[model samples]
Target: MTTPPQPPERYTQLKAVGLLIGGISSFQIGATLAKGLFPLFGPSGMVGLRVCLAALILLTIWRPLPGQLNKKTLMLLLPYGLSIAVMNFCFYIALVRLPLGIVVALEFTGPLTLALTGSRRVLDLCWASFVILGLYLLLRPESAAHGNLHSLDPVGIAAALLSGCGWIVYILTGTRIGRTLPAGLATTLGMSTAGIILLPCLIPTLPLIATHPWQGGAALSVAVLSSAVPYILDMMAMRRLKPRDLGILLSMEPMLGAISGLLFLGENLSSARWVGVLCIVTASAGNVLTSPRNTHH
Candidate 1:
């Protein structure tokens, strides 16, 4: 026999859903804004600025006091921060070289793959098949005889793959760190560490600020939209939701990315890509609906 559920638990579940929706929505908008800034700052400069600004903003808010830590925790967090840095850095690089919708769609493979790997049920295979179908549609060659191959850049494709791996690492590491640290504090420290890692890159770009004020402004906007706001929302969401459920909810990112691109950047996808999106979305929704109800915090 199962024990009766508490009211607090029910409220937490509802809150988790609300936070997940809000966080994903904000992240999508942030990606669109970052895409808008791509031409001006380039990917590296944009990411560097965004991280630095987000670090500053978080520092102001959290004011985390650096204290002595066990070597184990330090080792754990170092890679976690590095993963965050590399994930965003590579994502921006890919963004500059590819369409926003396509880049996001490609990145979705990371979490989807992770989800499918953990399940043994035959139904999970259907989800995997849908993801594979989506990827084929997303990565199909745009050019033919001339060999221009304009649909997706080879380097960009590679970076997106790398970013996806980084995201997987981020998710796994986040789970580990969540056991010991509050989500907000862990996030603050991670972003700060990432910002520090990016300082060298930002130094060279400092001079460009004089030459390209608009670019600098655009980068700042990217920081606020992509890193600062979204991170806070994500912390709130993660606090309320379980890791698996969070993954299921975040799978909406690709769809939101596609919509944002269409509305903000006037980017269009072919019928096949739309079908791909539908398949991935359906698989993700199915996963969430079928999963157990326990929250993930």
Candidate 2:
């Protein structure tokens, strides 16, 4: 039997919930902002700028000492960093040609698949079915309101799927790193490694920034909102929220991305896409709510 949480504990939990929502909102807003900059910087440049600057901001704030890094740390950070690089690179590439909400829903399949993996429960199959229906509705040409199936770019969809695969790698390696290093330290180092890998991509953006200095400020804002601030807030939230609660809250992201795209980027979705988004959101929430506790696959 468990005792009820006291008032102070309840307040802290509420605060953590707020932080998690804030992080999600920030990330969506940042993505919308990055989409706006695509005409100026291109997807590769924007990815490079966002991740590199985000890594710099995180490094400055966490300041992981040299001694904190070792062979084992490097081993963990390498894959984590590669995943980050691949995830962001592919995500931005897809974003360039796809609606923000659609991209988010598609990319979310990675974590959704991760959660539902190895579950033999009959109820879990319902969630999996929801995912499949949602994907079909979202990607089918007939579902397009404009009556043009080609409106959805095949390459963009493929990139989003690839990005999802990277996310799987990121989650697995990140979980392992969390056990060995402090959260902030591991995040900083992993981001630093990603920055190094993306350096060549960032190099080409320097000339463009030199011409338009305001672009630098915009990139920094993207970095803070998308990565640095979210990482910090998520770490803070994880300390107080249960994993189930955190996951349920996170399931709201696709909806939030849709809302953000509509409000900030003026990207409207068709009825089919909206239904697909809701289906994925429902499946994600159901998976978190119904999955067995204390069991890892």
- Highest-TM-score candidate: 2
Weakest 10 consecutive residues of candidate 1 by summed lDDT: 288-297
Residue-level lDDT of model 2, residues 1-297, one tens digit each, is 977769889899999999999999999999998998899999999999999999989878889877887888788889999999999999999999899999999999999999999999998899999999999888987534456554589999999999999999999999999898988888888898999999998999999999989977898899999998888899899999988889899999999988999999999888888999999999999999888772332
For 19-113, candidate 1 gives per-residue lDDT tens digits of 77776777777777877766766678778888888888888887765563456667778878898898889888898887787788777777667
Please tell me which predicted candidate would have the highest lDDT against the true structure.
2
TM-score of decoy 1:
0.86
CA-lDDT, candidates in order: 0.78, 0.92
Give lDDT for model 2: 0.92
Q: Which stretches of candidate 2 lie over 4 Å from their true place?
A: 1-5, 143-150, 294-297
lDDT of 2 at 175: 96
Give lDDT: candidate 2, residue 80.
Answer: 98
TM-score of model 2 relative to the true fold? 0.95
Q: Which regions in candidate 1 have their CA more than 4 angstroms from the true location?
A: 1-19, 142-150, 239-248, 292-297
